[model samples]
Target: MTVIGWIQAIVFFLLVLALTKPIGSYMFRVFDGQKTWLSPLLRPVERLIYRIGGVREDEEMTWYAYAFAMLAFSVVSFAYLYVLLRTQKWLPFNPQHFDNMTPDLAFNTAISFTTNTNWQFYSGENALSYLSQMAGLAWHNFVSAGVGIAIAVAVVRGVARTSVKTLGNFWVDLTRCCLYVLLPISIVVGLYFVAAGMPQNLHAYQDAVSIEGFKQTLTGGPMASQEVIKELGTNGGGFVNANSASPNENPTALTNLVELVLIFLLGAGLTYTYGKMVKDTRQGWAIFTAMAILFFAGFMLAYWAEAQGNPLVHAMGVAGGNMEGKECRFGISASALFATVTTDTSCGAVNSWHDSFMPLGGLVPLVNMQLGEIVFGGVGSGLYGMIVFVVLTVFIAGLMVGRTPEYLGKKIERREVQFAILAALVTPVLCLVPTAVAAIIPPGLATLNNGGPHGFSEILYAFTSTNANNGSAFGGLGPNLFYNIVTGTNMMFGRFAVAIPALALAGALAGKTSVPEGPGTFTTHSGIFVALLIGVIVIVGALTFLPADSLGPIVEHLLLLQGNTY
Candidate 1:
């Protein structure tokens, strides 16, 4: 709302824009198996991984094979992480000697990370040891993100290629993505985070006394490394439960800026990568522009709402914005920007609690996720998700023009459109159905941290976040056995349900011959197309979620205006 906040938002966006071309180009080369600056260093390592795994890098997979590989990897990852958590007591680097997780919590944590949901039902510092943090959770952070990027790359290939049997090899894309992209960037950012006063040690908890003589035990571990990838990978799991709000996790404004850029870095860049694959950079920029438009609109609303402060506080003669659940170091603008960015990308590492925001302010983040987080979504997930809308947009245009739809010269036929709709509906169905079941069930009602509509908002946000593969919580729900089991199910299907269909869509597109564009072909890279794309995204979101929003945040906002608090 202030000039400074606007300036901050602008600068953050400019940085993301600046990064798109280079990152996009690099990813293009990496996936295309072309040489780059890091080729000499990483090529051997990449080869070694393929060799050890006995994967034939030269062999291509059909869509079915690729989907199988992705699902198989996720299953193995979930199993490994589950075992690690359930048996963490005997693991090394237990410095705190934390007990092992219960069966349900272990299952939830494992699936959460494997799906890139990273919804931490337990506090990281209190519940996990160093080995579990690094070996179990952080390791999943790298591969799950790599998997997402790989899937996106496959979808791009499907759109870009013609009459191809294979999209690309999932294993190769996964390997190279981790080696050539994630690891290098994480190293630089991790070191920088360490230099920024974030912890990068294996030291145990340090007992300390505050000025007021309160005993405080400060936890430290391999945080800097996890912190960067957590943001960079859009894996929002925190080394501690405080997440980005903790000083040790996100120490300085410089680090804050870095984290924000990291969240959008790959997601924004992948738009350009899509353009590059499709041989149309403008196509990528169009998508990027649409994403930016949605991002700024949501951000401005969130910042404005937060800047206006709470009306109840104004009635109490307090002013200067809603700082109730925000860290003093971040203040209003930074916190608002962070919340908006995190939800915008499904990187749910929050600096401020959404539960404490003005209802309208909180509604923005909710809507962002509800819209499928396609406004600079998760690293690879965002582009493919938006591409779903692109298909829908063009299909609608095609229906209007009485012609078959084509995107990137590939026909968007009944099958492709069906897959797109299926992918798009996955989150809404998972989020809403489980949410309804929870609302009426006793165990579900027992998890309410508040009463009335605000309580309903909390439950809604939980399922929405998980179903969107966005792991942010509404900060009141004590998600226990039933909640964890159900949300865990939501996370798994939330991820693969869309992912598998997207790969299938990519396969469908990959096998099709490119149709020649005529005057009647809806140009996808124009202002009109961009407007159409935005309209489709918004209309779908509004239609699918308006009723839920009305019941949750919308009702809560009206109640708050009448000086009522749930």
Candidate 2:
């Protein structure tokens, strides 16, 4: 709305754009088994890991083998975290003396972090010990994100190589990703955060009297370290309940800017990495262009809606933008931008509450997730998710032009198309179906804190967030057993159902020999393709979720115009 706000948004975006190629190129080298600057230091550590685990770094895997390894690792991770959560009372670093989680809550929390969803049914400071926060949740954050990057690398390899039965070794890709990329960046960022006033310690909570004479318990633990990877890994599990909104987690404007940059950095850079692996950097830019277009459009709409504030508040003689649920330090523009960026990817760490936004403003975040979060989505998930739409876009283009669809030289045949459609369909089915069930059921409605359309939006947003593997919430819903079990199920299916099919598509593509481009072949890296890709992504999302959205935010917006409150 204001010039300064616009400048902030522009500068943030330019920073991301400037760093895309450097990060992308580095990631490419790291995954391609080429030496990097860090190899001298981390190479020994990386080799030691493989040796201790008895993993054969040189051995490649078929797509099925890769998926199996991923699934097996996730299962072990889920069980390990589940046990940790259920037994945190006995674990080390229990300064707060938190008790163990109940069975269902443990099940939900385990699956949530394991799937990289990080949905919290309970507040962190109240429920979890420091050991669970670090060893259980933060550990999952690193590995889960690494898994996503590995899967994306596999999919890219499928496109880059010709006549190969294998993509790459999942273990190697994951190990290198964590060792070379995530760990180094996280360390540097963690240190910067600590210097910027975020806490990193093992001290007990401090009890203090506020200026208003109220006693307050100040939560403290190993926050800066978890906070670094939380955004950097696109894992949004907060060490504290207030999340990034808390000064302990995200203290200043500089820290906020860093968090925003970290959220989009990997997702955006992966487009370049994709192009590099595919031997065409322009292809990456085209994908980046489409993502940027969607991201900017969403941010503009959110910022505008938040700036307009509430008509009800305007009639009440208030003259400024909606700041009800926003931090005064960041104001409307930054809050809206954070909401848009966090949902734009799967990084759901919010500096403001989406539940308190204008209906249309809240709608922006909802629609972003429902669009499959491919607008510079989660770290590894974004690239593969966009590739899903890319496959569909090329298929539709081929249908229109009366030619076979080909992408990166391989034909997008029935198998690939089917797999793409399967991946694409996962979101709607998981989101909408669970939403419908929750809307009518007593157990679902028992936790309702708002009435009518806004209430409906709460339920809709929960499922949408979970299915998108996004962890932010509407903050009104009191998640119980029914909600916990259902959302956890959706998160698992959302993460794997789409992933398996995507890997299968990559495998199918890898087996095919590259076809020479002909007169009828579609050029995928052009402006036309970018436009078409955007159209397909928007249209598909609109057709699938528009009705559900109408029943939620759209209807609520109309009612608000008539001076009605939910």
Candidate 3:
């Protein structure tokens, strides 16, 4: 709302724009199997990993093979994390001696992390020991993100390579993603976080006496390492209950900006990576431009709505922005920016509670997720998700022009369009069906912490978050058996259902030869296409979720204007 806030937001986007090329070019080399500066150091480790796993690095996989490898890897990751959570009390790093997670919570937590959802059903500091934090959760933060990037690279190969039956090997892409990309960047960012005064230790909770003579237990753990990747990888699970809002995790304002950059870093970079792979930098910029527009629009709406404050409070002659659920250090602008940024990607880290935002402000984050989180999206997920829309846009434009649709010389046909539509429809099915069932069922209703539309918003937000693979919550919904089981299932479906079909689309595209572009061919990198892409994304979200959104945040906003509170 303030000029300083506007300046900060502008500067943040500029920096991200600045970073897209360098980081993205490096990633292109990594995934394309070219040598980089890290090659000397990481090459041996990479080879050792393949040797131990008995993987053939020289081999490539068909689309089905790649999909199967991804699924098998996820299965192992889930089993490892689930067992680790259920047995962590007896594990080595139990400095706090926290009890083991129950089977249901463990099931949910494991699925949550492996799918890169990071949705927490319990407080991290209280429910997790040091070992669980590192081995169980942080491990997922690294690998799950790697998996997303790997899948995206596979999709790129499909688009870039013509008449090729093979995409890159899954193991090689996954390995290189971690070694050359995630690990090195994470080390640098993690040290900056530790310097910012966030905790990085194995010490147990300290017992302290307050000045008021009340006893308090100060929480501490291996937070700095987790904090960096939590943002960098767009896996936003916190090391504590309060998440980034916790001083021990986020610390200073400088750290806040740093974390924001980290959350957006790879996602923005991947757009350029996409361009580099497709042999068209303009193609990447077109997608990035659309994402930036959506992001700024959402931020402005949220900031303005929050700046307007509550009309009821204004009627009582108290006038300032809505600071109800925001930290004073962050103020309205930073809080609003954070909400939009985190939701813009699938990163769920928060500096302020979304649940306490004005109804319209709250609606923005919900809609971002419902739009398939493709507004710059999760690390690898965002670029691939936008590519889905790009396909749809090209198809729509083809219909308008009465010609076969072509993107980057590869014709977009019925098979490719079917796969894209299948992937696009997956999240809506996963989100809406479960949400409706929960609304009518007893156990689902049992999780409500508020009455009326606000309560309905919480339910809708939960399913949307899971279905989008976004982990942030509306905060009021209590954890229950039904939520644990259902949301976990939603998380898995959200991640893979779309991902597998995307890979299939990639394979289908990769097998075809590129056709020559003629005078009638539509340019996907043009301004008209960018506008069409954005319109398709917004319209699809609006038409699909308008009724549900009207019942929740829209109704709530109207009620608040009439000086009513739910």
The lDDT leader among the candidates is: 2
357: Cα error in model 3, Å: 0.8
Lowest lDDT 10-residue stretch of candidate 2: 323-332
Candidate 1: where is the Cα deviation over 4 Å?
none
The segments of candidate 3 whose C-alpha lies over 4 angstroms from its true place after superposition are: none
Candidate 1: count the clashes.
Answer: 0
Q: Give the Å error, residue 28, model 3.
A: 0.7
Task: Give the alpha carbon lDDT tens digit for every residue of 303-406 in model 1.
Answer: 99999998888998876899988888788999999999999997899988998888899999999999999988998888889989999999999998898888
lDDT per residue as tens, model 2, 465-539:
999999999988987999989999999999999889999999999999999988788999999999999999999
Clashing residue pairs, backbone N/CA/C < 3 A, model 3 = none
Off by over 4 Å in 2: 210-212
How high is each candidate's TM-score? 0.99, 0.99, 0.99
Query: What is the C-alpha lDDT profile of model 3 across 345-375, one tens digit per residue?
Result: 9999888889989999999899999998887
Let me know the TM-score candidate 2 reaches against the reference structure: 0.99
Give lDDT for model 3: 0.91
Question: lDDT of each model, Cα atoms only?
Answer: 0.92, 0.93, 0.91
